[model samples]
Structures are given as structure tokens and as C-alpha cells.
Target: MTVKDRIVEIIAEQAVLDVSDVTMDSTLEDLGIDSLGLVESIFAIEEAFDIQVPFNANDPTESDFDISSVASIIKAVEDLVKAQS
Candidate 1:
């Protein structure tokens, strides 16, 4: 599957939402993802792609934590997948 597909799958699985509920602009908050869910999703992403996402508290909008939209999440995963390749 493509990175976007994988991201959507992750969001669906982690957020406990239907695949159809996920959209490119859908935010985690919109999907009812709490802090714990967010952390779980991050861990799932890390394990799925076998990449460690660096943390940066100074930048709350960093890709790893800034899962404001499905597009952004997909971009982050794509970057990690590319890096590993």
C-alpha cells in the first residue's frame, strides 16, 4: 500500500473510526483522538514503518505531534518511509 493508504489505515485503526470517516483534511481532534490515542498512534506509526520520530517540544507543530490533518500525517509517514528506503 502507499504511504497515504498506510496512514489512513493507521488513523482508522488507532482512532477506532471507519476507514471512510478519514479524510485528507480531517484532524485528530475531529476524529475523537485523545492524548493517549495520539501517543498510541505515534507508536503504531513508528512500529509500522520501523522509524523513530524525533520529538521537539519547542515546536508543537512538528509533524510527529502535529497530526492536525490526515494530509500532514501522510506526509510525515511518507518522509519516514523515504528516509528508510
Candidate 2:
């Protein structure tokens, strides 16, 4: 699957929402993803892509590193993928 597809699946599984409900512009809060859910989703994404997300789980808001929107998350993942390549 593509990075975007993987991200959508991770969010869907973690947030317990349908994939159709999530879009590039959908925010985590819009998808009903709480703090714990966001952490879980990040972990899932890390595992799926075998890459570390540059955010502190303990303080998601610190340094504005937390990904609030699907588009931002996808962009971050794409950057990581590109860096690895």
C-alpha cells in the first residue's frame, strides 16, 4: 500500500472509524481521535513504515510536533520515506 493508504488504514483502525470518513484534510479531533488514540495511531504508523516519527508521545503538543491533520501526517510520512530512500 502507498503511504497515504497505510496512514488512512492506521487512523481507521486506531480511531475505529471507516476509511471513507477520513480524508487528507480531516483533523484528528474531527475523526474522534483522542490523545490516547493519536499515540496509538502514531505507534501503528511507526511499525507499519518501520520508521520513527519525530514526536514525543508524552507531550504531543510540545514543539507543535503532533500531527493534527491527515494531510500533515501524510506529508511527514512522505518526508520520512524520502529521507530513508
Candidate 3:
């Protein structure tokens, strides 16, 4: 699956929803995912792509990575993967 597809799956799993329920505009809060779920989702994404995510658990707003929406997250991950390549 593509990176975007895999990310949607991860986020869906974390939110306890079907993949179809996740959209590019969906935010973690919109999906009812808490901070723990967010962290878990981030970990899963990092593992899936084998890339480190620059996220701060204590203060997510302080992190450089954007977690505002699924679309933004996808873009960030794609950029990271491209940078790695």
C-alpha cells in the first residue's frame, strides 16, 4: 500500500474506525483519538516507514511536525520518506 493508504489505516485503527471513515480533513480530535492514541499512531507510522517523527509527547505544539490533519500528516510523511530516499 502507498504511504498515504498505510497512514489512513493506522489512524483509523487508532481511532477505532473503518478506513473509509478516515478522510484527509479528519483530525485526531475529530476521530476521538486522545493523546495516547496520537502517540501510538505516530509510533506506528514511524515503524511502518522506518523514519523518525519529530513529535514531542509532552508538548505536541512544540514539535516541528504538523499533526493538524490527515492530509498534513500524509504530506509530512511523504516528505520525510522522500528526504530519506
Candidate 4:
């Protein structure tokens, strides 16, 4: 699957929602994913893609990785993957 599709799946799993329910505009808050879930999702994404995401769990607002929306997360991951490759 593509990066976007994999990310949606990971986020959906963390939120305990169906993949079909996740949209590009949806935020982690909108998916009912709390801080712990967000951390878990980030870990899963990192493991799945073999890349380290520049996210600070203690201070999400200060982090470079954007989790504002599903689309943003997808874009960030895609960019990371491209840069690493």
C-alpha cells in the first residue's frame, strides 16, 4: 500500500476506527485519539516505515512533525521517506 493508505490504516487502528472512517481533514482529536494513542500511532508509523519521525511527545506543539490533520501527517511521512531514500 502507499504511504497515505498505510498511515490511514495505522491511525485508524490507533483510534479503534475503520479505515474508511479516516479522512484527510480528520485530526487525531477528531478520531478520539488521545496523547497516548498519538504516541502509539507515531511509533507504529515509524516502525512500519523504518523512519524516525521528528515528533516530541512531551511537547507536541514544539515538534517539527505536523499532526494537525491526516493529510499533513501523510505528507510529512512521504517527505521523510523520500528524503531517506
Clashes of each: 0, 0, 0, 0
lDDT tens readout by residue for model 3, 1-85: 9999999999999999999999999889999999989999999999999999999988888788899999999999999999999
| Best by the lDDT measure | 4
Worst 10 residues of 4 by lDDT: 56-65
- Encode model 2's per-residue lDDT on 4-63: one tens digit a residue: 998999998877889988888999998989878888888888899898788887766673
My TM-score estimates for the predictions, one after another, are 0.84, 0.88, 0.96, 0.97
List the RMSD of every prediction in angstroms.
2.2, 1.6, 0.7, 0.6
Instruction: Compose the digit string of candidate 1's lDDT tens values, residues 28-67.
Output: 8899887778778878888888888764535647536456
State residue 35's C-alpha deviation in candidate 4, in Å: 0.3
lDDT of 4 by residue, 2-63 (tens): 99999999999999999999999999999999999999999999999999999998889888
Give the TM-score ranking, best first. 4, 3, 2, 1
Give the better candidate number (3 or 4) by TM-score. Answer: 4
Q: Please, what is the whole-model Cα lDDT of each candidate in the order they appear?
A: 0.79, 0.84, 0.94, 0.96
Between which residue pairs do clashes occur in model 2? none
Model 2 alpha-carbon drift over 4 Å, by segment: 61-66
| Candidate 4 vs. true structure, TM-score | 0.97
Candidate 3, clashing residue pairs? none
